[model samples]
Target: MKKMFKLQWLSVLMLAFVLVGCGAKEDTNKETVSKEDQQVEKTSYKVKDDRGVEVEFNAVPKTIVSLQPSNTEILFALGVGDKIVGATEFDTYPEEAKKIERVSSSTTFDSERILALKPDVVIAYTTGGDDENLNALKVLEDAGIKVFAIKSATSFDDVYGDIQQVASVMGIEDKGEKLNEDIKAKIAEVQAKVKDVKAKNVYLEISPKPDIYTTGSGTFQQEILNAANVKNVFADLKSWPKVSEEDVIAKNPEVILTTVNYTENPAAEILARDGWNSITAIQNKAVYFIDPDISNRPGPRIGEAVELIAKAVYPELFK
Candidate 1:
């Protein structure tokens, strides 16, 4: 009976040893898992948007919905086009954007549709000042969808900031810096080409006919004019200004650049204006049409806009 008890005691001790080993192994696995959780937590980040709102991301956004064409273009330029599950109807650039689902119109936003898309974030624009769009974005925010509002860019510096903002949010800061550098380099090349050219008086019309709209000071268009070695005849005015024919006649621009494409021949329409025939631009036949998209959108194609303006204003030098 004593021998039998000794054997049973030995079995108990062995069982206890196995249990302790299993416990130690389990603790080591728990420690490893905790360390992995910490590593993942380190990847989270926070960025302040244009509205001075702090937005935090647990990881790079897996999906995006861009509310502005400029924002869409910027995202595509950053090589994140595949992640854009929703965009505005106007996002027709880069070909790939056309295939994405449209969540907003020029004047309307479909909050229900955006919510249905279930994007990780929504990139919005504050330029339009449309209450409806703002309301839709509010709905998205209330639904726990991240909404980042980008400020309207008014200059090249602002454009760079916008690119950086989008890049930072997408966790591709290096790519954003490279893009800005490329844009700056292209602008520098155009500037160097026009450095020896004389600055000319230019009237850039964004709208036509009875309701004439033109860009003036404190606008990206004006900056493009400056970069191209040209003077905006309406520089004295601020932002987009509506002026009478008399005002344009008084300015007497040497070169007229129009972004009107609704008509078949915008340049011809400008040339045939009642009193514009007497203007120097009309006499010199220098009324040129600029691609509205490149010239208007403050995105990666700003350098092309500068080149277009420079070449139009100084054909001899550019050629």
Candidate 2:
């Protein structure tokens, strides 16, 4: 009987050992399968920018080169400040972006210098690729660098949308969505107060010096004016056309808008111009100064620009 009991105990021990081994094998298989699945499921998307450019990355780029100050501001806002390996001159706003390597000088890009840094992505403007500066993009592409061409922002939506768009390209889609919603709400609130108000013809002056440039039909500044329900006097002029004082007098502009960065106040200087005093905007003292940093930069601050203009152009509408 004792011998029989020992045999039964040994058999039970063997069965228990077999079960434990099978369970361990099954767990190991599951872990291996999980790792394989993760490898297969990982994916990323390529975005085609304004210049008909295609750029690819590993879902989220670890290093970036910002070619424009506006783009730099957008990247910082998107919480990807650490990703930026280099930035352009005058990327001073927000204070922190200034610390990055200055790869571009005065809106001009240097591909050779940039390529040496081994950045994962490059963000630039089509306008920055003008006659004075060769589009440094081709060299970077030939060297296997990723270039993300940011389009010139015109309207309020473009400002907000581009922020989200860049975030998406950088694989921070959630942050982009939140940013877009916030700007949209802010814009809608501003628009709600200004809607149904009578529109005025506005002449947006770039400068009041030897030559004057004004925002026209195709310019982004014109879109901002339209958003505020102000009719641009040079709306018929194509793409930031030059105008004379006589033109302003003939147009009979009800309002004048210009960059605030000028040495002299644009409103006061324009009123002092030879023929500009005859303009209705001057006669009514409707000329106003707007901060060029906010007004001109085609970035996230455009909503603030709209509000600034709305208040200056139609103070009664806000109240």
lDDT of 2: 0.66
What TM-scores do the predictions have? 0.84, 0.77
- Candidate 2 residues lying further than 4 Å off, grouped into runs, are 1-45, 51-53, 127-135, 155-161, 317-319
In angstroms, how far off is 160's CA in candidate 1? 0.5
lDDT of 1 at 1: 12
Backbone clash count for every predicted candidate, in the order shown: 0, 0
Which ten-residue region of model 2 has the weakest summed lDDT? 18-27
159-217 per-residue lDDT for model 2 (tens digits): 66677668656665557667767766766788888888889888887766677777688
Candidate number achieving the greatest TM-score relative to the actual structure:
1
TM-score of 2: 0.77
Model 1 C-alpha lDDT per residue in residues 115-134, reported as the tens digit of each score: 78889899876543443445
- Show the lowest summed lDDT stretch of 10 residues, model 1: 18-27
Q: How close to the true structure is residue 16 of candidate 1, measured as C-alpha lDDT?
A: 13
